[model samples]
Target: MMACIQFLLLFCSFMYIFNVNPSCAQIPNSPIRSLVLPVTKDPATFQFLTTIYHGTSREPIRVVLDLGCPSLWLDCSSGRLSSSRRLIPSCSIQCAAAKPNNMSCAFSAAMPTRKRTACGLSTENSIARSATRGELVEDILTVESVDGSKAGPVTTVDHFLFSCAPRFLLNRLARGAQGMLGLGKSRIALPSQLASKFGLQRKFATCLSSSDGLILFGHEPGYDSIFGTEISRSLMYTPLVTSPDGSGSSQDYSINVKSIKINGKRLSLRQKGIGGGTKISTTVPYTTLESSIYSTFIKAYKESATNNYFLNMTVVAPVAPFGLCFSSKEVPSSMLLGPMVPVIDLVLQSEMVKWRVHGRNAMVPVLDEVMCLGFLDGGSKSKTSSSIVIGGFQLEDNLLEFNLGTSMLGFSSSLLTRHTSCSDYHTRMMQSTLKDS
Candidate 1:
């Protein structure tokens, strides 16, 4: 009886222990809802780069943030391949997810002579305007998890699929950047994969600046404490539209712009210019508008600056990229929005929804004495599909939330108006995390 009792006691103890603290394999990982990537702008290239830890070694890999890219791709030759990496076979389900029409696998000329049944993915260098074939491979990826208020412990995603491109494809990318981190709406895009893994809402936010910035994957928490005002509350959203002609990737995000206004005065623009749609690009340094739209905008802006804000401002010689230049001595500065100039408003779906562009975003300083209009004349409508390509300069210091679930883009015009910059918020977040750690 004593032996049986002892056995029963042992069984009971085991059951209690199991219930209290399960084995490592049996314990399911807690879902990490949010992840953050530290973004930094490349001074020479004017491109934004974000860091992600990859492979067994957890090596930090910096990659360009491309909103239109279909998937994350890297120049495999640049970094040591992790032993845990797995090559995806051609015509496999994973390959189909990445490239729907991909049938036969053809190895790149730069690939090794050894024959392997690996999936071939097409990778592009948007800046260099080059395309090359890359092998699809999977490895572990790690990123810092956050809870809106503070940064948490590091979380990882095993078996993260990415392309292995040739070393030559790395040309024209930001210095030290190994590849591109695609945030497009494709199945294999970084944001989509992260959302799927964490069971998070299909949304992400980007706060871009000249220095360090932040990119949050998944639903963001309240920003009231950080920015003085709640970013979610102040965000103005507009429907994300796809181009009719579909010249670029179907996953590319675009918005419908109804009209443009300078200092509350509507600019006379052709309906065709407005109908072409406006696409967001991180690669483009400055905002580019169609020739007709540019002409109308420049004329109206010049008139506004001369008559309203800077009556004594002298028109200096036109800068290389910018057609309009003004003497900085005559241009007044503001505490809230850098230069005291006319506000440029982009009217969206309705008259009520407008993206107000402050002076800081409208003007760029080329020299100590000269400040020029930052906008570029993007040839004709035939040359480019997008009527207006909103570039990185205009997007800097802006808090933009791209919600893939609702197909809506929520934007906080400029963080400067809120008396906070992306760099400031990022620095604080990092410092807070360090202090807590």
Candidate 2:
């Protein structure tokens, strides 16, 4: 009995081990102060979202951390959630009916893009619209976080407002995230609501890599605490600007980029005479390059490679929607020989920041050898006045922080030296330690 007790004590010690993988670059001096889990990258779809546990029963629901969206939603039609209501249209008599007790009521969600047209008249004296059906529920939602008291603690939000989507045209990509957790500037969004409810600051950070990273809360215990003092001071920061058109769509993390360079050759994309027109953008799910900018970028890329290769080895005329296509066998492992792609630098006037999107993030791997540019074309002129929309692919290893308190968008190089995550390393140690004991 004494031996067994000793074994139990030894096993508990192993469970707390972290970053056991020596290959990891920089281990956080302390445990990370965030709720983090490995993301689900649908290899077939290139979706970098994760499913989370929510509701009273803690049912699993896949959600996207979308800054572009303004609310949290779940798919009830999937049959995963048991308590959900389908709302009736205002034009119908059921709309004036009394609220149901104990049961949550579903309603037509206001899709900003579609206002008045966002509803439907039910046939049984009511009609539910196509993409706007959902519910407003008050329940306890749980989130796992590091409380400084222990390694992991449950964050419960009582009477939280979220949606239940009964009908939202979910395709291969949209279906990847059954619900969307809005990180936008809107107060109704999850982050803002989470902060206001808990009296915590509205600052959050995400170190999202392909493997494992964390979504941290409360600025006090985040990067500043996790990173050593010297390392924290060296981080780069820029103002989180609003939409160029002053549309007040606070979702975009905008910055003024001066020019783009390849091998130090400024791509002649600078502002010409009196007025300038260069905007590089990165938004959630995509990083977009202006039409002319992308064309010039591709041309320069082709000239830089040996044998004047654009997307080398791969052949086939450029297809619709995509201009540059490459054969699977022909592409190099990285255009970036080091921290940057061979010699590409995106020069920004904000703080004279020269950000480099590593080759791994710049060129997305579609399949075996098939690769495509990670950026999309938002036409020569975007209706929103944004020339470029910075997307997810370009943010691979970087840790991005959107701090409302400081009104700054800060970023730093990958905390992990290599690709392996701390969580994976910890799990492996637990498994091995148990076996040896």
Candidate 3:
């Protein structure tokens, strides 16, 4: 009896320590929901989650495996994201079919070297030399099977190209989405090993929405699942959140409005929009959305866009935008809907100074200041130089809100002052006049 009691007690202790609270313990380690990250110039690397889909059946059987680090390379011919790209036929080799050096030889030849230049940007660097009139390059995922011992040769068709890029630049500058996956039947792209090893057979699906339209991923049914690290975690990636189930539901995320102080007066920022939500979008054109408000405020202050004046102050939280995942679309809807992932409202940790303008008099003070930060685009051949690109500044909401023509200047809240009054100028101009008198 004594021995039995000791054993029972030990077992109970073990269970308690593990918190074998079946309900919470049952939750899979993988995030049920897939987060949409903001478009990044570099790449994301990590040991995240993976879901496998079979081409013929179009189903998701499992999603829990380790995808080693993957690289998302830019398609030089067209400035867009790409996983394992096609080899230029010219790069083909004469290796006998028996030896099968096709994949190796082809990849070596087509991979952009520091020597190639396309569209004014070096194919080697992949960064746009001058902003072009084409599609915005977005996410580039490279997937490989972790279970290499069991699989045969991986096929080229096994790769995928998801269409997700900025729409405005699509026709003007973006490369035509080269052989993008059609959401048609029986087409497959996810690396085969993920299916065989992880038991992930269902084709996971999601829509990257934007002002443009909904973008389907996993290609209707067949799609490529690049195995490896995401580009953002590896480079300069902004943060973002995902729905709990990876369902892409808007309700799953958070958005916060910290404080709204107008002209040194505090106002409870609790106004709701049409849907009883915090944010509302007007059909107004981008240029006009804030133009009229800005104009009215500046004109009243007798200033120009160059002049710093009136502002609407708002504090924001930080969340990663999702649009960064797809770069192959002629006009990826992600550009419209994915980039703004209410990080501010969702996290509610940090505060951002919003430069808002209401009707007339400079309600908010103008903080004239400049700052310099660092930018890192790791893909550049020169890693050191690529790490410090001299970015911009940032502003806070103490007494003023900072802004430029329409750019995110930076995060510095330092202010600049002007001595426009003749009296103020004369004080500096004629210090001797006052002393002599």
Candidate 4:
């Protein structure tokens, strides 16, 4: 009788523990995950996300998340390194060579001696240059998710490999932050590495707001699932173009933009060279139209574009670099979005997926009332190049999904309005995040 009583008591305790802790449940079918991140304002407002890294270092290393580039390299100027970079037993024969270009382990110019040489790398997009040989080491990286998610971006990999550049001149990073996390098409890319370990597809979804945004893996969380989160609207997908040559560098996101329309007219993109399709970028946020394309667009918008957002302010004249300008005396500063602006839509295909860039998204306020067309002229053209580079500003407040398994890029528009001042937006987002915490 006593044995029977003890067994019943033990079973009841076991059931209670299981019910209280849902984390003890077995793994589910979903291999998907999400990484919620806070957006950065300056340099390129709402252009990039600060990636939080978890590694051997004492302090957390924050790196910029760049999807356009193919390699991961950090600015060691500020990084604290006990093991500068762990050298592979063999860098030559057994170790695989890096991509986009024939980037391999070689001696850096700064330290020419073979004995002193670790792996280093360098680039010259306008021209070809020598590779920088450096050391390859493994490290763990993580980012927090939104809605106070307990299970943030989880990695199945034992250890992820990343290149360490001891010293290098990266002008783009000069204006903002240090280091970069490349999520490009290369096999060495972070997404690919994560997929390899888990035997899952190389896919990710990113929702970009001017403030707090989130990134999801595998699939967008459905409300019923454990990784559930509500999405703004329906998703629109466009097929990605596999590079012209087998080389996948520049082609990770080069989508064929059949046509471009401004205010309802077909704007001509007379490429000086042979062929140039449109590509999307996370680094550059302003839409850069070629000189001829810009000319045609400016002519079209000039007739209808009005600056009524700040009538109380002084209506200053246009200045150099900018095609239009305005000023304010009574209003103090210009308004973000004018009363009414001309509709500028980018038609990718049929009416289904029109990347209708909000008027405010296409205009950058250089100074008070001084707004300029966010588009720029592609100084020189390449034979195998992109006609228009859709910058991040155009993608702000939108959810973008990159599915490598299907070779498709999905777009979903959000109804959220952006704040004129990034600082104000960031503060509000941080406060909201804190409240959730």
Alpha carbon deviation, residue 347, candidate 3 (Å): 10
lDDT values, one for every candidate: 0.80, 0.50, 0.21, 0.52
What C-alpha lDDT does candidate 3 achieve relative to the native structure? 0.21
Q: State in Å the error of residue 72, model 1.
A: 0.7
Q: Locate the minimum summed-lDDT window of 10 residues in model 4.
A: 121-130
TM-score-best of 2 and 3 = 2
The CA-based lDDT of model 4 is what?
A: 0.52
Kindly indicate the candidate among 3 and 4 with the higher lDDT.
Answer: 4
Candidate with best TM-score:
1
- Kindly indicate the candidate among 2 and 3 with the higher lDDT: 2
How would you encode candidate 1's per-residue C-alpha lDDT over 357-414 as one tens digit per residue? 9989988989998899999998787633788989999999998889999999998898
lDDT by residue for model 3 over 89-116, one digit each (tens)?
A: 2211211111122233233554455113
Tens digits of per-residue lDDT, candidate 4, 61-163, equal 6556676656566655565663423443332221233422322223324323443444334421111122455455555555443233333333323345566
By the TM-score metric, which is better: model 1 or model 2? 1
Query: Which candidate number maximizes lDDT?
Result: 1
- Which of 1 and 4 is the better model by lDDT? 1
Model 2, runs deviating above 4 Å: 1-38, 80-135, 147-151, 172-176, 224-233, 271-286, 306-322, 325-341, 366-372, 413-437
How many steric clashes between backbone atoms does each model show? Answer: 0, 21, 62, 13
Question: Candidate 3: which stretches are off by over 4 Å?
Answer: 1-254, 262-437
TM per candidate: 0.88, 0.67, 0.20, 0.70
